[model samples]
Target: MEFQQLASFVEVARLLNFSKAADKLHITQSTMSARIQKLEQELGVPLFIRLGKSIRLSKYGETLLPYALQSIQAMQKGMKKIEEQKSDQTRRLTISAANPFAGIFLPPILAALHTLVPEISIQVLRNTGYSDEMYKMVMDSQIHLAFINNPHEPGVYSEESAVCLIPLYEDDFVLVARPNHPLTGRDRVSTADIKPYPLLFMGQKTSISKHMLRYFEQQQMKQQDKLEINSIPGIKEMLKQTDMVSMFPRLIVRGDLENRDLVEIPMRQPAPPLVTYLACQHDEIEPHLLKIIQESLARTITELGHPCRLFAERLA
Candidate 1:
């Protein structure tokens, strides 16, 4: 029998009155009676003992009552589960970040979210590769949002592209070395000055490396002695112990600079600042949430001694 027939049977069995059961189910008395009659015919047994104005459950109805109640309860639970899934789909956000943003910005962002939007559930995918992979993820809708260094040069992404890029901030790359390192006292450190010391390079694929390479090419300088370490923490630890120097986003080493654990080596000509962007599928994020994220990052930049410049106005 249909679920409606089963539902009618259970309600009638519970209430023991046709009119009350009909009112409870929001069905007409005639409709309720027809449902019961159909259920009885399907089961080949009478479900109610009719005594003029009163009624009681027949033997078959008593046996079927528990099973019908179970079926109705199961259906209700299944429907509730479906609704819960829909709610989660609406409330949840999945975001990816490049390694540097994940390390420097994610914690504060999460803290701001907890205070501002406690009901929102966040799933953060960290260090999921460089800008190209991040761009792909946003374009493919694999993640709701991504924080990455802008992978493209100027005018590379056209208006026809499915992905939208929101400029967040530009992080200046600074040359850093351990306190008291020889280059630290220089008024203006040049590429030739840095050549004697071992240079620690971030992964070549990293945006920082790409920018540094372009800077070196422009300056016609060659780095003879170099070490490549993909992990930022490892590079920092090495800097603390050795005389090696590396270039990093100022915000990444803000604490070290404050504590005098590391000193910035003034460059004769600084490398280009790394511009970060929030990439997403067009119209995938709510405007309010986007504003909150931007404001949070702005707050973080201010807290970090304004190492990065916040972009122009928010995206239209």
Candidate 2:
């Protein structure tokens, strides 16, 4: 009948002593006897054969033992499942990302994560500079995951290391300026052509700046009138008001391009595209969560209609 009644029946049957079964169940002997008596009354059958000092299962009790055991086990399993679900509701995950991903990838990925796993909470650490630092965060277990750029570079850790890098997309740094800017209508604009105008740089430590500088070094050219503005929005606004031009990831500038506020200046020799990676320590994240992140990223890219390919598809 009741859970305690069934439980008392099983325990009393196993021990063959009401006092021992009561002690084991942490109840009084009278309480245990009451539970067993109630169960027997409900079934309309005597469960125990009482022989003065000794007791054993009656025919009815023998038939009910297996079913009682199964009922207790099922109840326990159901309780455990409820506890696990409650635990999931309170579980929290922390992730870090570079500035580019903070703008372009993070918003959609977060929306998707909420839709898929609404029970779990997410904390984001944004604008954590460079691939090497992001890689270190994952390795040190300071964060569950990181969205970084070009972790496969010379100094940064690789897939061969403890960190696993899942490539999400590649964004080429394009020279962008206001629509009415002098360089906008050019068929072929060289770095030499870009030298005269003020160049807006993100930060000396950023991947974008590093890659842009590397491209300049390779071309054996330098811009004299450089203005360093660490903020992307700041750089875009400055471009709108002034003749200054900036090299930015195409993905980040998609909206500005669509609105005709900024136009990509065709480069004769463009800087190499930066590869964005989802980095995590091996077995650090649950497989289901990782799958959700990957699916979210892929879906976001598809919805944005960005010309980027997922690493798995690239390998295929």
Candidate 3:
């Protein structure tokens, strides 16, 4: 049952000499003999056949030898793995975020993170659900860090503790429609300019949707024809089929913009900016790696010009 007992049984079985087994294990002969005896007593079987001057394995010993060797090997492997983890603790890091932000932002940040900490083992958890779910994971220390969009909303993290909310970038919402949509040709578009077209808004619960509703109320315009969509891809596809314009974080639609599949309809006034925050556990994240993550995020945001502008800060 005990690892030490099994190891002694194996050594003695291999050498077939108690003295030689003890020498190999760097233990006294009597101590090694006691270990084998203890194993035999626990298993209710004598492992050795005493034939005066010679010794040979009994039937039970032969059966248990292979099993004992396997157990020992397994334990050795387990110990080795533990040691590796301990030695490389600083090399492992994990981060999580919601689907849209992760897809649009995480890759560049990871690229920069790798450049800065080439030896690190990075684990990115994303699309795990809402920002609140990601926030909880970071708070629980299940993940080392998280990128949360609009974390300021009530009930997102009602109870805050040692976690530091480092603002990564401020992303602005922009009205986007299919490249050749009627509004794209307009020299200037205002809230009224978009009133004639159908509007595709994100779900009401989202910060973007709430902000859009406020914008409409401010302009005193009603969305006569409107649709609520939760999936970003679904909204993009729907826009192509109809003359509907939707508001999205500008960085999110960079690919469509580059392909000219989606064009931004210039506005007289900017939509409310959604600031993406990096939630890091002070106890979980190392100071040096935290700095790397912050710097990498800043670099990536700067490289990708659009709705996102890096918010500078140093981790104390």
Candidate 4:
């Protein structure tokens, strides 16, 4: 029944010589015989055929060999599973990011994380609506870490939320127009030029979107007149047909910018850059999640690709 007894039984069965088995097990011959006898007694079967000084296995002993080997193997397997689960429970890093966080930033970070900590599992809350929702989730202990682009909304800097935002990078928002737009031929456009068409504004919940509203407020343009959508893809799909130009974090549209699917309209106004940050609960147990977030941000900065003169001038 006990592991020690099982080990002794296995050793004795392997050698089939009581004296040698006793020596291998670091016990006296009498002690080894008593343990084997005890095992036979516990199972209520005669395990050995005593032929004077020598011995051999009985039918019961043969059957118990398979059972004992299986029991030991099962115990080892059970212990291994427990260790893996414990590592996951403690080593895990849960990240919640808005949809814009998904495509470019996370992939390289995830690949590097696999190389850094192969045992740790990461859970991503993708297609999420905004930082407010992510903030709520982290406060509830639903997620461990995130890289949130601050919603330029009111109350974002307040202490009511049990979260801390650390600045990682500042990304500018660009007016993204599909190919063949009437204004694509222009060198630059004024804020006045942005309001006439069905503009695909951000869902009002995000800070990036709120910043858009802020830019309009500063420009004194009435964006409330144009079409608005909560989701990014919805805005992109709308732009495929309508004259609706959408805005997004520049890091997110790097591929589009390169391929010309989305052209940056070079707005010359003093617009605020979206401050992308690493956010977490005030009390997080696993500290490794922060490393994962930092490493991911570094990868994001590298992949941003040949920072344009516009980025340098606008960021300045």
User: Regarding TM-score, does 1 or 4 come out ahead?
Assistant: 1
Q: State the lDDT of candidate 3 residue by residue for 173-229, as single tens digits.
A: 778999889888787788888889988987776656666777778778788988988
- For residue 276, what is the lDDT in candidate 3? 78
Clashing pairs in 4: 151-207, 152-207
Question: In TM-score terms, which candidate is top?
Answer: 1
Q: Per-residue lDDT for 9-71 in model 2, tens only?
A: 999999999999999999999999999988889999999999998999999999999989988
**What order do you get sorting by lDDT, best first?**
2, 1, 3, 4
Please give the range of 10 consecutive residues that has the lowest summed lDDT in model 4: 307-316
lDDT of 2: 0.83
Model 2 segments beyond 4 Å from truth? 1-91, 118-121, 152-154, 158-160, 313-316
The alpha-carbon lDDT assigned to residue 244 of candidate 2 equals: 95
Error of 2 at 117 (Å): 3.7
Query: What tens-digit string does per-residue lDDT give for candidate 4 at 1-316?
Result: 6776776777778888989988997889898888888888898988888899888888888888877887776677567758967766646778767646666667777787788778777787674757777766776667877767664445654676657766656777788887888777788788888777666777676766777777778888776466777666677767766677877777667777788777788785747777766677654424465556566665566666634222211110
For candidate 4, the TM-score is: 0.60
Better of 2 and 4 by TM-score: 2
